[model samples]
Target: MRNITVEEFRASCAAAQQLEIVERKGMGHPDSICDAVMDNISVRLSEEYLQEFGEILHHNIDKCLLVAGEVTGIFGGGMVTHPMLLVIGDRATFSAEGKDIDVNSIAVDTAGRWFDENLRFVEPEFLDYQVELKPGSAELTDIFRRKEKMLGSNDTSAAVGYAPLSFTEKMVLDTEKYLNSPDFKEKYPESGEDIKVMGVRKDSDLDLTVAMPVVDRFLDSEEHYFRVKEDLTDAINTFIADYVEENKVSMDVTFSLNNLDMPGRGMNGIYTTVTGTSAEDADCGQVGRGNRVNGIIPLNRPVSSEAAAGKNPVSHVGKIYNALSHRIADRIYTAVPDVEEAYVWLLSDIGAPIDRPKVAAAQIIMKKGSVESVQDEVTEVIDRELENIGEFTMELARGMVPLY
Candidate 1:
């Protein structure tokens, strides 16, 4: 029997609460880089496997690490003293039916392609890659050879997803995206992609502090750096102000960029980078240290601890449950009436059918109705999603679903 539960949430949701905090690590951040690169490698491997073999094989390439390289630069110029090191590893099916797949080439090629597409200044040559993906163990590889089309859940794990993002949450997510947008970059090429945004909301007001590094090549002098900083700050503030007013997004939203800069400290005070990311010199990165499946990190709400990126889309509970929980939560919030917010939790048992979770639970914060009133509708939504979980897994295998 499938375990399912629904209950009324007595306390206020994050949106209703007066104080809320949310965070987002932009794509160029070291941790995000690792997540993106590893996830890309997994997707490529899945595609290759499906093409060569008739089925998507067993694999999980979630492990990845970034070691910071050395770099030094002055205004108008900088050079990488040493290239960044990217170590990617995990498990995969290297050989099947006496045929071998080149996992190493796929990983390195995928990682290189991801860098070219995402980070403007960081080239493939600027980083060295070490792929440590080995074949899965005998017991684990046997799971994929089952007679049934549906794979069993490979791990016991729990994931939570909430719907109806609060205004503060929206601001934090969208602002980082805006900073990384192509138009923003064209207007201010000095802006780096290694940006992080933190939002603290009190009641109806929000204060957003953004840390976006500057490209050393674009900066000519200390004065020029300050000017660029001021220009970028004013531009972002203006955009946010207009965005809130035009879209009716939120109240009293404020934006500040690079608050750590000091006037005369030379390179010490400024947040400038040879490349657009800190992975070139200052900080390292790893998988799962970036965003959740929903993108923003909403501190007030329960979230998935699993890093969805790079895990096998078929049977890995960490990746599947984490992504599905959000879809279920969103569906509930949209389908049910008078529901202020919906949170969906899915727990998986190892060796259980992937379609049937160990526990499918929903905790509802009502807007105008009691949990009893919406109970049947919420339960129906969860049941429907769980039944259709295989389709979701297919979508994941096709790279149609966004995991990061």
Candidate 2:
């Protein structure tokens, strides 16, 4: 049995009449890069530990930082003055018996491989000169060592998730995915992976602000950059138009890319980077600064501040519960037609069983006068989802779920 609470609420994300804003930091954003690298490090550690010890060890490499690099570039060429600095930090059990796990090597190699696969403008050699690793503090490591088993949570934290994404939320998230998809890349080879999509919904008007990096190798001049931007804008607009028509939603949609522009400086004033990410010249990055577990940053929606990336899949409630909350909310919303919006909040105590959280709460805003009739059904869904929380670890380990 689970300690679960279900309640009906009048206010919900979908019922908000005011303007709503949603944001997505694409895969190549510096903060996203940090999140990806940390998650990869965790996965690599889990794999190696499983191979050696027959079970994953206790570790969490969620803390990381990416220091921006200095670079100068033009339309056709650029030079890097300083390489980006990556510092991977967190607690881990790397030593057992007479054997010591080379954690630094794992971290560096994972980051390099991620960059090679995701970043088009930056070479892997840049990471060879830039990345560093700092082990977790002795006190934190001691705390982890005190855990009774490998699957117990080592920290107390709360994770929040909501389901049935609003129209703008889905649009914003899918736009980023579409732009970064392999099909889009094939058509726009000069487009870099570092992309940010911001969607604003004001009644029937939808406004999108997109920031994308242009690879210098593929762009010969400022005109070429503008042309590519126009092409991208056209493609995105077509997609949005088709979506609106297909979904039977009425909205006036508009797009503006890279709003930082000067009067005299045209393309130069826009969002351009040598490495296809602002980390090359303007912005630094840190883990947990990017997307939430559900992907979109919905400013108007309730969200948890807990960072999910790189936490242990086995028992870290911060990671498991965040993903689980989303799953629960999604399930409830789908199973109960009366539920217009569902918000799930989970609280976990350190050293407690992973499946049985301290509190599992679900708040729902149902269709008018339908809450009383469907309360039992909604409660049943929540109870069923809570019962299956233990399966989240295997799903996460198998890469069936994404933390960001």
**TM-score leader:** 1
The weakest ten consecutive residues by lDDT in model 1 span 247-256
Question: Which candidate number maximizes lDDT?
Answer: 1
Model 1: residues with Cα > 4 Å off, grouped in runs? none
- Which residue pairs in candidate 1 collide? none
Q: Tens-digit lDDT track for model 1 on 282-338?
A: 899999988888888888988889999999999998999999999999999999999
**TM-score of each candidate structure, all chains considered together:** 0.98, 0.92
lDDT of 2 by residue, 1-404 (tens): 77888887657456266699899999889899888889988888888877777666677888888888888886677878888888888766677556688888888888888888888778764553343445555654454455454345667888888988888888899889998999999998777788999998888788999988777767776676777778877888898888888778777878887677543475466556777888887888899999998888889887888888887777677888889899989999888886788888989887677667888888888776666687788778878876676576868765568876
Report, for every candidate in turn, its global Cα lDDT versus the true structure: 0.88, 0.79
